[model samples]
Target: MNYYSFLLKNAFEDFKRNKTRTILASLGITIGVFSVVMLIALGIGLKNYIRQQFENMGSNLVMIMPGNDLSEGGFSSFGSSLATGIRFDERDLNTISRVDNIDYVVPIFMKSMVVTSLEKEELASLMGTNEDLFKLMDLKAVEGRILEGQDISSRSKDVVLGISIAEKLFDDAGNAIGKTVRLGNQRFKVIGVVEKMGDPEMDGGIFMSYKTTFGSINPDKNFFTIYVGVDSEGAIEGVKSDIEEALLKRYEEDEFSVSEQSELLDVVNQIFGMINSVLVAIGSISLIVGGIGIMNIMYANVTERTKEIGIRRAIGATKKDILVQFVAESVLLSGLGGIMGLVASALIVLVVRPFFPVALNFLAVFAAIGISSFIGVFFGVFPARRAANLTPIEAIRYE
Candidate 1:
């Protein structure tokens, strides 16, 4: 028979001779592999979940909110501002659009008032913007169409209802499209209804032309929020920096703040990395416990097979053969456990995927297998060597 076949036969026989002990050793390895796999899968799932949440906000979109500038002795914070003079207007939006690496720039004005229908009345936030707002913010109307340039130029008294507001004012999604809603005692026809935005605050607001809303509500402030989109993924940081510099130069003060999509994603990834590290550290303790169990079982097996070792030594079996047999037994036990653990982990991920999106890392599986096999070899060495070195007479005399 070939060496491979001979080794397999001997390992199987040895396993059969000590079924309970072999099973106990394999259980330890199974637990270790299972812990490591589960921990890794959970970590990846959490990271993906956070990423999806951030993506739901918008892609390659950044908002520059107003802030006050607070400068100490001489050092300036990278993007810090504590002055209250960072009011944005249509002119700022136009200036930002002319900067290099900018895809689109949108200016927003907001106000809160009571919106009333004939049947019911509700409080809602009113947002005003130009036609480019749709493209810059990646917003789409689910029921009807968005506002046009003519609507802004003519200061039309038309309104777009958000999904939640539509539901509250009108009976159904379709009915809300053409119904008239009163905003702050002013009657405006609902020309469109936005799709369900995920955010409760945004879903409770109404969208209108910037000229109309500003003219009707607060026209003198000229204070608004700006949304800027970079030309490409690679240009996000550079574009943000250029916009900040331009604003500082124009305003003659560092009173503006800038945000980038990549910066937000980096913060999210860092938080997830810390969480994953803590989880892996806890899982590693289980692996150490499992390794210790493997060593204990191996020592017990050596004591039980004392007479067997003596009988084999009295025959033609060499010390090398004895050592090889014990080591092979250790590896077979751990290797089988690792395979079973991988299958079980996959099954678990499949079952939980419907409730939570779980991402499996194939690299983590291979690493677990390698570690388990290495543990078998490292822990099995001392016991196997002790058994191989036992003299025939001494082992035979052993009870």
Candidate 2:
């Protein structure tokens, strides 16, 4: 047989002869690759899901939030509220509404509280907004009707139940409407139930008039966020600048931030990008440990084959031949492990993707396998050289 083919055959024979060592060595790499693949898939899936949610809100959507600096706007600040005591008030909302090229101006208030129905009680978010919120969000009720101008103007105690709360409270959509639910100490009559939005935050929630929220639940707190819909996508930049200029003129310092949907999406991408990198780095730690395992196993293999090495070297075999053979075995072992990991990861993704928003990441898969091969080569070097350097006389005489 050809020398190269004979060396390849020896690699396979080594694995078959020492199944326990081969399996144990390969197991580490399998685990490492699986972790990396799964983590990256999860991160990508969540990022895509979040992006889709924002896109569903509409391309022309703009958000305003209270910030210490004009550029430091954020979505939530449970702790910062106590520290800064800075929040958007009705005056700020009115000022934003006065900006030209704006379609709807709505203030948003979100609070987590216990909601009790006739037969059950559960935790839910109480979202307070004006009647225009429904139009801006493009939300519709599955039954009954949404709030109107009168509801906001009169500060009516009417409430809208999200699908999740409706099901948990009243058992069905039809039975939810016109039901009275207790939010904290106050009672709110459910006038409508919104369709299943699929967003966890908005789905299992209660929608109430902003005036009622401010007047009753949080009399001391002001609005913290505002939603503004520009009349056209083209005019978004112009309107954003105009709002910033107006707010800057009103406040001595940059007390608030104005951001468009596209800009927010960019920020989301950057955050997820960092998170993915960190996750990959964490997962790669396992790969390094696995490489160490491969190295240890390779060293042991060289020890066991000392006699075999002497027999070959005493005949016509060269040091380079022994070196190549050992290296090939190491590469084969790790390559097989990487392939198994890919299969395992693919199976896991199949099982999870149905329940989650995960997608197959081809680049991550390739990188994991490539890294495994490199690990095999890197860790196999010392062992391969040790086997090659054993003199025929010494190796043959060794007990």
Candidate 3:
């Protein structure tokens, strides 16, 4: 047989001769690759989902949130729940409105209030916002008219209900309009029921005019967040810079953050990036363990085949031939293990895709295979070198 045929024949025989050890080693690789594949897929899928939601909200919207650190271009306004930052007020809203590129600026004040609809009562988010916010968010009332400028100017006690909130509060979602709902001891006539948004934050909201709710609750209280709409897509960056510059005049540093869709997407991507890194590190631990397993089994193979090595050397087999044969055996086993791991990862993705969004990561698959190939060679080197260095007489004498 040719040298390549001889090497292939010996490698296949070695794998068959040690079935249990080979399977165990391959299993380690399978588990490691599976972890890497699933975790990365999860991160990518979540990032895409969040980005899509934000894009749906509006491409030209810039969000202003209260925070001192503007290093990352923006801080997630959702972080305000920790009560760690200052709040913006009406003066800030007026100041932002005057910025050249800004088309609309709506202040948002959030509070947890007890809302009662006849006999039903639930604790829900009470949003103090103006009619401009409805247009900014692209929200349409399904049953009745949304809050109008007249409601804000008149300081009318009128409320808008999200579809989910309306269903929960009234007998039927359509029936919610024209009904009276109590917000913290004040009765407000429900004038609108917003269309189903499929967002937990907006879907569960109970909205009223900002001036009305804020004036009644506490006129001095500041807003939690502000949404700004720019006139043109090209003007977002200018608006962001103008906002930062305006805020810097009042506070020693930038006490507020200005962010557009791209900046927010960047923040989400960064967060998911860190999460993916942590997950990848965790998965890589298994790969390291698998590599160690490969090493141990290869060493054992050398010990078991000492007499065979001695016979090969005695029959004019070069040191290089002995080394190549051992290395080939280890590489073949590892390659098979990697292929099995890829199949297992693909199966896992299919099974979980319905429950969790997991994109097929072709790059991760290729990387995993490459890493596996490297692991095989790396762990096989020491044992192969040992087999090559063995003297014929010494190997033959070994029991």
Candidate 4:
């Protein structure tokens, strides 16, 4: 057989001879690999979950809020001087809708009022929006229908209760729909109930027709918040710019802000990237410990095989041959440990998937294995060289 094959055969035999030690060493590597792999999987899963949550809110929707400039000392000074006087009216909406790449535009007006059902009453924040608002913002009715165009044209008092509001006032899901609810002494029929959109305590808000809210209830409140949707993903930035330009031209002020879904997603992804980096750094510590374990075991092996090294030197084995054999053994041990660690990592991902979101990335697995094997070689070199360099007389004399 070839010299390399002979070294490999002897290495295998030595590994098999000390099964317990081999298993113990492999266990250490397995633990390290498992931790690193699991952390990566968890980070990926969390990133995806956050992305999905944002997507559910609306993928293409952008929210524009009044920005306050510290230098100017007011919300109006931050954007355009006209923004201070300009209430987002139908004229503004019409102008924005005419902008190229804009698919839909809707304005929102909010009011805090006491809403009373036949059985009970509660204070809630009511939002007024148009039909396009439902489509643009992913607002859907779980029980009944959303506000219609007729509700806006005729100034109807129809309202859609938030999931939390529906649960608190109504006995069941079905009962909440078609029930009459009084909003700040103004009676309106509840046409729909929003589905439980998770943590309603945080985002629980009611919806109503824009005309009824702005034209009838509070004609004095002229200003409103606007939501705009771009026709396509590629057009989002252009649409935002066009809208800002149009608004600036009309009102002669740049007092508005535009947000894109892609920008929001990028922020979310950056957070996830940071989390993964931190986790990977933490997991690297285990690898260092495993490498130390390898170095220690290789040193011990050198001491125990002193006589064997002397014999090999006596039998026409060159220093290079001896070096290659010992180094091969160390590499073999570490490579085996890495393989086991990779297998354990896969099992860990599978086991923990039900409890937490985990996705097995083959690239990560291969990377872990490669890194562990490299560590083994790096730490194993010194001891392997010491064994190969031992003088035949000195090694033969060693007990």
lDDT (CA) per prediction: 0.77, 0.85, 0.82, 0.75
Candidate 4, residues 1-399, lDDT tens digits: the string is 988899999888888988888777766676777778878888888887677666765666765444322223333244453345346677777778898877677788777778788988887877877788778757678899887888877888788878888877886668888889887658898888776655343135678777787645667644456888777878877887787777777554435555565665775687689889899888878877887787888888889989988888888888888877877787778778778777776787788777666787787788788878887788888888998899988887889
Model 1 per-residue lDDT tens digits across residues 3-66: 6678789888988987887777788878888888888899898778767656655677776656
Tell me the TM-score of model 3: 0.81
- TM-score, model 2 to reference: 0.92
Top model by TM-score, which number? 2
Q: Which residue runs does candidate 3 get wrong by more than 4 Å?
A: 1-9, 72-82, 112-124, 141-145, 154-198, 215-220, 241-251, 312-317, 351-357
1 or 4, which is superior by lDDT?
Answer: 1
TM-score comparison, 1 vs 2, better candidate: 2
User: What is the TM-score of each predicted model, taking all chains together?
Assistant: 0.66, 0.92, 0.81, 0.67
In terms of TM-score, which candidate is stronger, 2 or 3?
2
In order of lDDT, best first, we have 2, 3, 1, 4
Q: Which stretches of candidate 1 lie over 4 Å from their true place?
A: 14-21, 50-103, 106-134, 137-139, 144-226, 231-238, 246-259, 354-357
Let me know the TM-score candidate 4 reaches against the reference structure: 0.67
Clashes of 4: 4
**Residue 182: error of model 3 in Å?**
5.6
lDDT of 2 by residue, 191-236 (tens): 9998876688888989988889976687865777888999998999
